[model samples]
Target chain A: MKKNKSDLIRYLFFLSAILSIALIILISFFLFKEGTVIFKEVGFLNFILGKDWSPTNTPSSFGILPMILGSLYITLIAILIGGPVGIITAVFLVYYTKDKHYRFLKSIINLMAGIPSIIYGFFGMVVLVPAVRYLFPSNGNSILTAGILLSIMILPTVINLSEVAIRAVPRFYYEGALALGSSKERSIFKVVLPAAKSGVISSLILGIGRAVGETMAVVMVAGNQPRMPKGIFKGARTLTTNIVMEMSYASGVHRNALIGTAVVLFMIILIINLVFTIFKERNVNG
Target chain B: MSKIKIKDFNLFYDNFQGLKNINMNIEENKITAFIGPSGCGKSSLLKSINRMNDLVDSCVTNGNIYFDDKDIMKTDVTQLRKEIGMVFQNPNPFPMSIYNNIAYGPRTHGIKSKEELDKIVESSLRKAALYDEVKDSIHKSALKLSGGQQQRLCIARALAIEPEVLLLDEPTSALDPISTLKIEELLQSLKDDYTIVIVTHNMQQALRISDNTGFFLNGELIEFNETDKLFTFPENEKTENYITGRFG
Candidate 1:
């Protein structure tokens, strides 16, 4: 009877693992099927690298370079603003804060992450957009606003991941460093951070992925003018926002073209995830 | 002489007292070992010197600890720590290359030239008796070395910083018999320059290596005596029972 029960438990775990893989495969298959139809009609190369993106008109062109460039621009801004702050916050929490305060601060960060994405977008629309307008009054619904809002949206993720990474480094590392007559900052930078390199990189990558895939918030604040952002204050559209904005009004070739944009967005995320995995693996082996 | 003086020291972990009023003096250029069963505050006393106990969330200390006549509690902890090096029970090498592991300390102290750092790294490794084995591959990841080699490398790292005092918490507790002997020899040689204070569980190690030994039991210093006398003629019954394996 005990043997049978143990066998059942093992089978259940095995089934769960198989189910997860199957779910990923299923999602990939549907995405590819929906995505490839557009690529087949329009050459994949042209769909990827073309410059113009007017879906409604006759001379209809869906060169998505502007959207890609816009996404890259906003993501870079968010990283610049958010990455250092997140890492510093994590360091403060791990190395400096007392236990009670650490827990309190940690809970606040967790609550920030738990707040709904749309709620953050709504908050950005209400608060940050106007704040940006006030600061840069000449440019309304600009890329700068989108970047700042997205940086706020992803701050919790960066902080949470960085905290976990820093905390995961064994206590022995700190003790060893201290014993060797290293100052707390020296130990953190020279020993702790280096050991947690993989975790830090993954956190940054996760932040980038979050910034890249963000649509609703960017749309609300970005002024969605389907152009490459020339300045931080200039309005722009990203791949996800372009898809969301056009999908309802799009029909036939236009629909396919919009879906093709989704496919491109999907590929970009895939490439990001691939690079993340490759970097992690290289660090492990290297 | 760079002696460590602890006068009327007591320690507390939050509300619970961990160590009682203790007075001890560790002489310069000598290997002093603290021995006791677990939870007896052997490690606590070692940490007090470098102010490592300050990092503990609820830890608090009372009384004065002096190294080289400077009141440790009042001294700049960062500067004090930089002068007194420590090695833990387990060998922990940073995830960097062996060269960087030794050079990290000197670099932090503002030795920036690569050529100068290379020389420092070589000399430190030689002092730790690890140079010959790892000289060719100092750039390799330190994590790849064996447990014993890692421990020695940690010692080299501490030595590289040129600390006046070396506090070792069971430096050979994790090593094999051969490695332990090698470390004992290394410690003996190191006594010419460093004020060595070690905490050990192995009575044999304390007997073999230390110039002075302090036997602690249940947060009290039961006896502090010359190494030879402590082994042969302990004044306290508890110390005698402990050395004779009556009960720990």
Candidate 2:
């Protein structure tokens, strides 16, 4: 009887593993089934590189080139601003912060991560949009504004992950450098940071994933125009924003095209994850 | 002449005494070994010379350490540390090409010229007796080297900075007998150019390499004497017990 019970438990564990794989298969199955219809009507190249996205027009052109460019540009700006700041902040937290203060600051950053997306969206709409408008003399809604907001939103992930990576470096490296008459700053920057390079890079990749997938806040601050991205000061629309903006009212081929936008977004995130996995594997092997 | 003078030095870590009142003078360009059981404060005194104990937040000390005539506390910490290099029990080579690891210290001291760095790298590696072995793979990641090679690489790295005193805390405890012998030989050669202080638990290592040896028990220096006399002659019962392997 005990053996049978243990076997049942073993089977149950196997069931959980299969269950997760099944869930992923189900999700991809639905996405491809619904999203592939637009490809047949619009053709893969036209749908992907299409410039015009007037889904409500007579013939309804569904080119997503502008949204693609917008997503890439906005994500680029976020990383450009957030990457160095997050990494530097993590180094500071690891080397400088007092024990009690470090705990407080780390938890506060964790709280920031736990904050809902709508709050960020609301904050960006009310405060950041106005600030950018005052500074740039635009409608206050543009790729630059959205990128800045996304950068703020992604800070917690980048800082927390980078901090973990930096702390994982052995202390003797720092000590050995100091003993060599290298200053504390030099030791941390030269020896320690390089040792933690893989971790830092993966942190930035995760931040990129979050930035590219961000929708509500980008839609609020990015001026959500369904055209190709222009200058930094001009408005833009992203893949995620396009899907979220019209998914509710969209029907038939238009709705399917929105799902196609989701399919593309999923691919980008999967690629980022694969790159992150490669970095992690390399670190382990070395 | 003495290279470093310590007078009435005491170290405490959060109310726990690490090193009780200590006084010693290390001779110039000679190897001085501190031998004791674990937690007896030999490593603490070695770290004190370079002000490395400053990294320990709870650790506090009130003492005077003099490098030649100048007080180390009054000297610029960065400048002081540059003159006093250290190596630890475990070999810690930075995860970079061997050339970059050796160049790190000189670059920090503002040696930016490529030719100058190349010259320093070669000379330092040669001094540590590592240049010939690593010549072909100088651009390879330092982490790829064997245990003894890594330790030698660390020594080469320390030499690159052109420090006056080299402090090693149980530098060979983690190595095999052969690697240990190689490092002991390297230190013998190193002493002619730089003042050397080593904290060791190995009594034979002290007898073999050190000119002067200090024996510690609990938190105090039990006896300080010439290596031969300290091992051969009768002085403190504790030193005798430790050397005879009766107790540590």
Candidate 3:
């Protein structure tokens, strides 16, 4: 009788686990069926490398190179700004701050993560748009403004993960460095931080995924120009922003093209996840 | 000549006393081993020599530790540690290359030239008797080495700083007999150039390696004497009981 109940519980867990995988497979099947349809109208090579995206023009061109470049460039800027700040802030929290202040500082970072992305988008539109406008004299929605906002959005993720990685390094390494007469900063940077390298790099990888997949916050500030980004200050549309901005008004082939852009975005994130897994594996062995 | 002098030392962790008043003179160019049961404050006293206990917030010491006739507590901590190196119980080689692990101490002291670092690395590894085993793969990660070799690499790393004294806290407690014998032989050779102090749980290790031995029980120093004399003819009843494998 007990074995019967245990078997039932095991089946319930197995069903829940398989259900998530089934849903993912179903979604991927639909996405591929719809996404590949647009390739029939616009040749695959032309669609990927095409510099222009005019979905509503006469015989609309379906090139998405500009959106890909936009995604790549903006994610670069966010990593540049957020990566160092988060890693260093984590080092400070783990090595420098006392228990009392560390708790308070940790909660503030957690609060930043809890904020909704749409609220962040609203903030970028209201404050960052005007600030950039005052500086660059454009309507203020540009690649730079969106990138800066996204960097802030990724900070909580980078800091929290980096902190966990740095904290996970055994205490003995730090003490060993100190015993060699290394200073506090030297011990942390040279010994403690290096020991936590794989974990720290994984944190940045996760941050890049977050920045690349961001759509709603980016669309409001990127100006949706659909042109190849000429400079940091110029307006642009990322692969993600392109989909969200056009999916509402898009129809037929145009709607499929938006989904095709998603397929590209999905590939980018999949590659990022693959790199993350490889790193984690190397960390275990090496 | 004395390498270190501890006078009327007492250590407290918040309200709890960790070590009672202790006084001892550690001779230069000799191996001094502290032996005791667990939690007997021998490790605490050894940590005090290098001011390592300063890392503990609640730890307080009332005493003077004189190194080369200068006050140790008043010396700058970085400078103190540079002159007095340490090895821990567990082998902790920084996750970098073996060459880098050995060079890290010298580099921290502002030695930048690769030529000088190569010299220091080779010499320190030789001093720790670990060069020939790791010379070909010196660039490989230090963590890849065997446990005993890793501990020797740590010793080589401590030697790289050219410290006048080395403090070891139960360094061989985790090692097999062969590795323990190798370290004992290495210490015999090292005493000509470096002042060595070790804390041990194994009374046999103390007899085999150390020139002088100090026995402690319940945070108090019960006896300090020559290793041969102390183990063969312990003056204190508690010391005899501990060394004889008869516990009260």
TM-score of each: 0.94, 0.98, 0.96
The digit string of per-residue lDDT tens for model 3 on B1-248 reads: 89999999999999988899999999999999999989899999999998999899899999899999999989999999999999999999998999999999999999999999999999999999999999999999998998889999999999999999999999888898888888889988999999999999999899998999999888899999999999999999889998999973
**Candidate 1 residue runs with Cα over 4 Å from true position:** A1-23, A279-286
lDDT of 2 by residue, A141-250 (tens): 99999999999899998999899889989998888888777888989998899899998999999999999999888988899899988798899999999998998899
lDDT winner, 1 or 2: 2
Clashing pairs in 3: none
Give one digit per residue, the lDDT tens place, for model 1 in B1-248: 43998999999999887789989999999999999999899899999999999888789889899988999988987778779998989998888899998998888788999999999999999999999999889999999999899999999999998999999999888999998898999999999999999999999999999999999988889899899999999999899999999987
lDDT of 3 at A117: 94
What fraction of the genuine interface contacts, i.e. the true contacts, does candidate 3 reproduce?
Answer: 0.76
Please give the TM-score that candidate 1 achieves against the real structure. Answer: 0.94
Compared with the true structure, what per-residue lDDT tens digits does model 1 show for residues A1-286? Answer: 9999999999999999999999989977878888788788768878777777776668777778889899999999998888988988999998888878988998999898888778888888898888887877545688888888888888888898888888988889887777666778888988899888887887888899999999887888888888656788889889899989988888888888777787788888998888788766755564
- Which digits, one per residue and each the tens of the lDDT, describe model 2 over residues B131-182? 9999999999999999999999999998898989999989999999999999
Writing each residue's lDDT as its tens digit, candidate 3 over A1-286 gives 9999999999999999999999989988898888988778787888889998998999788999999999998899899999999999999999889899999999999999999999999999999999999999687888889889999999998999899989989999999999999999999999999888998998899999999999889988998889999898889999999998888889988998999999888889989999988877776675
Which portion of correct inter-chain contacts appears in model 2? 0.86
Specify the poorest-scoring 10-residue window by lDDT in model 3 chain B: B239-248
The superposed Cα distance between candidate 2 and the true structure at residue A172, in angstroms, equals: 1.2
Q: What is candidate 1's TM-score for chain A? A: 0.90
